[model samples]
Target: MKVSAKLFIVGSNSSSSTRNAVDMACSVLGVAQLDSVIIASPPIEDGVNLSLEHLQPYWEELENLVQSKKIVAIGTSDLDKTQLEQLYQWAQVKPNSNQVNLASCCVMPPDLTAFAKQFDIQLLTHNDPKELLSEASFQEALQESIPDIQAHEWVPLWLLRYSVIVKSRGIIKSKGYILQAKRRGS
Candidate 1:
């Protein structure tokens, strides 16, 4: 069996969310360690706009999980060559892979391809939207599900997506999403 998870850090606030997401995923999947965890951060500007300062803490948190044996490998989503290079140079646990959004780029940039090849980093493709879940959409879902006025004040902080697979059979056994939210004022 193998378990893979993806953490989407919503908005600009992802301080401790990475660790919390991984811990919650581990608990939910009944596993001590996830086979892989890919982080998808909110888009800042464009391919050149990924901020290292903002990403450093999240990467550090994942590195801690790696050191503690809570995660086997960690990767990132939608980073260009410059951004990936900056992250790779600074990260304690270098990214093992990077996911490119095919919806945005029909062909992978040559520089990014060369860098990945040089570093032996796997280049994967995905079709996830730039914003996986928006605050307004989250509030709408909350209102629909809870039918409470207070649902409007809640803000989604992050989303964790997990998939458990039967490795031997190459089939998915289970998959689900876990969302974390907070009140507007708090």
Candidate 2:
């Protein structure tokens, strides 16, 4: 039996905890790299919160991984027109795509659409919340399920996704999640 594979994971911990997530994902998936990882993050810079100054560090890190052949492509979630423009203009390795949550807005913003077309940056639509698997919710769920466990002592770091495929079929053979949990507060 022969199986080929591809996985694109949407995640909310890229800015705060990318390394941990990547490490865990690599271990669980038994693979060296992911085809794509669309990371969730909010703008956190002064003045123009969505400027290159805010996003450059994160994207550069991802870019380094790409240059080192760790990840094939890096994408961002929930960036609007001006933010994406800032990133595109300043990044050494331009993002392969940007993901917009349709739930937040019924349709893509016109400015974003136009910019994406001009720059050829793929715009993907997602239904997932901007903050997927928030720490408080994940902890609450775990506490309910396992009374012995101190859920608060463990932080929900991130998620890793993997897939197996049959090349001829062009369909996924299997897929799974590797969740990163970091222990804290003794």
TM-score of each: 0.93, 0.78
Would you list the clashing residue pairs of candidate 1? none
The lDDT for every candidate, in the order shown, is: 0.89, 0.67
Local error of candidate 1 at residue 126 (angstroms)? 0.5
Error of 1 at 16 (Å): 0.6
Question: What are the clash counts of all predictions, listed in order?
Answer: 0, 0
Model 1, residue 46: distance off in Å is 9.6
**What lDDT does model 1 reach?**
0.89
